[model samples]
Target chain A: MLNYLWGAMIFIGILVAAFTGNMAEVTNGAVNSAKEAVTVCITMLGVMSMWTGIMKIGEEAGIIRSMSKGLRPLLKWLFPSVPEDHRAMDHIATNVIANFLGLGWAATPAGLMAMEELQSLNKHKERASNAMCMFMIFNMSSLQLVSINIIAYRTQYGSANPSEIIGPGIITTLVSTAAAIAFAKAAEAAS
Target chain B: MRAISVLSDLILPLVIVYILSCGYSKKINVYEVFIEGAKEGFKIVMDILPTLIGLMMAVGILRSGGTLELISRAVSPIVRRIGFPPEAVPISLMRLVSSSASTGILLDIFKNYGPDSFIGRFVSVMMSCTETVFYTMSVYFMSVKVTKTRYTLAGALAANVAGIAASLTLCQYLWG
Candidate 1:
């Protein structure tokens, strides 16, 4: 799937660029984006360090453990394959909390850490486990409690009520999350 | 608006303070432990860096080639048939790949139509609810070296469709 998507993007992109007479711009786009990728990594490095550091403190203090334990039942239901006390649960819980609060910077590192933990539990190391797919799907569904970035953008654009969409946003996100859970669970069952 | 924003600002500071103090009281070498955990950041970054570069470059090429505009033009009419505003088709599509690219389209909408308009509010709600499905999948999977992702993308697309459908219904019920 990724192989096809990647190929289509590059192949169709170049063809369209030629047809549109924007070949040079497309070349620059690819090169500049590669550079921008490194820039994004640098930013990720800073945020990941700070967030992981704080999360480590929470872990050692047993705050993280207790919080994840509190969420054990829900986590267990969402991730049936994972053992109850696995370390991935800790990172997954933190990721969910951070995302719910719209703390995307904190969520990414925890989410990636969760992925690494889930990978350790993967039977076929190259193939994603059901748990990993389920986890990633949940992340994609992205049940954020707040849409701060959208709110800020609305404010910037001089909307009369910048946060008016928050209610609708939450509602729509919940619907998506429900759909995601159904789809993931059904897929798990099918396979 | 004010209530939610205020709650959000307070939560972060409180969490940070609580975690640090708890670690301190627990007799943990808080600073050293933080340093140790922070070292994991470099490894994580290195693991996913190649995937990030490839994904971004593809998105960049796709965007620069005007493929999004073309697709949006083609998709707009069909989306309009479903009572979804045609103007939102671009941001909705771009949000699947590059968030920043979608933001550019979003700002264009806000500028042209005003954010208070029905289309503005509709797109806002949709953008708020949706995720960059491909980007999220790529970085997460790449970090773990997972080649065969199976149904994750399919599940995400299902969620995206559901999100858009819900956004349309909610916007209409509330403000349409």
Candidate 2:
């Protein structure tokens, strides 16, 4: 998906620039943007490191596990078919907790694990079961507690109040997630 | 806005303190553990660098060649009629495709309009609530080799639409 989009963007950009006689500007923009990408990463490196470091502290301190424990009831409701003792339940809880804490690196592995475990419980190998849809909907709905990266970007760009958006972000994400749960259940019921 | 800002400002500091205290209570070698995680974080940034560069270059080319403007202009009237800032049209669309690419568009937005601008805050909140729907669904569904993902896509898109609308409304009531 991204491959075609990336190719089209570059191709259309140069072609359009040629027609507009702005090839020189496009050339400079390409170079500068690449350089800027490095600068942006340097800024992100500090924040990402610190955030992950702190979250790691939380992880090792067992705070992350406790949070995942708190998420069990919700997970049970979301995946009613999955047995409570199933490995998939643990993976799903871990993934949801990782995502909530913005530990994306941690989430993907657990998410894949959860998917495989769910697959093992699948009756139809060719179709996504209801549990699978519910799980995917929740993940795609954005269950994050904070927008760390956006806050970092805002800080880098010199916002007077970098974290001001955090409250609104949390509220907005909660609303979307709630709507996601409702939609998932409605879809589940209709089918 | 004032109340929310103060409350929001409390979050990070409180979280940091909480984690440190938790680590201490657990008798963990907090410093060594933090360094270990920081190293992991460093690797993540390294992983993102190439993708970020590619996205930046692509978006930059699109922008500098005036193609973005052409599209933005074509959509602004319609967007304005819908009460969405025209500048956000591209960001929202790009977000559904690639996260890094969307970040590029967002940074462009922050540059053209100050990060403190309404459109800037709007997209920030919107991005916070939405994910790369097509990318996530495709990857996960493919993992199970399921060609027929019946209601997942619809449910996900429904969430995104609700997210966009919710963010837009919240931004208007709070900051617009």
Candidate 3:
């Protein structure tokens, strides 16, 4: 899927640039974006490392376990296919918590681990399960309690009140999350 | 808003203190475990570097080639009918596929219209309210080797649409 999407993007970009006589801009964009990608990763590394280290202490100290325990009822409701005591639930809870806190860099590792754990429980090797689908929906539209990135950007751009959007952000994300959960549940029932 | 900002600032410190205290009480070597987790985090970043680079380049070409502008123009009429500023069309569209590209668009909007402007606030809210659907789907499914996504994409895109609609409506109601 990604292969085809990536190929088409590059191909169509070059073709369009040729017709538009903007090949030079395209060349510069490609080079600059490639460099930007590395810079982005390097920036992410510091945040990711710090959060993951704290999360490690959290896990070792059983904070994560307690967090998962508190989240069990909700997790069970969301992923009925997975057993209540499964490790995937813990990872899912951690991922969702990280996402809710607007710690996307910290969420990826736990989200990946959750997917892997869910995959292991799958009877079908190549196909994703209903639980996995629901998890993805929730993660994608996860309710953000605080959007640190947007606030930071607003501050950088010289907004008078950088955090004013928190109210609207929370409301919008809640709406999206509700929509995602409803859609996923409907799809699950239909199938 | 000030209260929320203060709370957000305290979250990191609170988490760190809680974790360290818990680890101490539990008689665990917090430093070693933290290093182990940090190593895993570094590994994960390394693993995703190639994918990130590929996506960035694709997004760059699409933006520079003027395809995004064309699409934005094509969608402007409908978007305008819905009361969303036509300038936001590009950001909303690119947002589904690439975070950085959409961010670039948002910065442009902020530059043209100051961050306190209606359109600027709308874009900021939208950015916070949504996720990069294609990027998340690709990276996650690829990591798990799930070739058959089985409605995950549909669900995510649906949520993205909901997010955009909600942001637009909320922004108008609250700030317009």
Listed per model in order, the count of residue pairs whose N, CA or C atoms clash below 3 Å is 0, 0, 0
Q: Output the number of the DockQ-best candidate.
A: 2
Q: Candidate 2 local accuracy as lDDT? A: 0.89
For model 1, residues A1-109, the per-residue Cα lDDT tens digits are 5577667878998899889888888988888777866765665576566666776787677774466567778899999888988899889998887776555767899
Error of 2 at B84 (Å): 1.0
List DockQ for all candidates: 0.44, 0.81, 0.49
Model 2: iRMSD?
1.2
Better-scoring candidate (DockQ), 2 or 3: 2
Best by lDDT: 2
Recovery fraction of native interface contacts for candidate 2: 0.82
- lDDT for each residue of candidate 1 in B68-173, tens digit (9 for 90 to 100): 5677677877877888776677678778987655655665567558899998998998987889998899999999899999999999999988999998987787
- Inter-residue clash pairs, candidate 1: none
Each candidate: what lDDT?
0.79, 0.89, 0.79
lDDT of 3 by residue, B44-74 (tens): 6687678777777876787788776677788
Candidate 2, B126-145: lDDT as tens digits: 99999999888888888879
Sort all candidates by TM-score, best to worst.
2, 3, 1
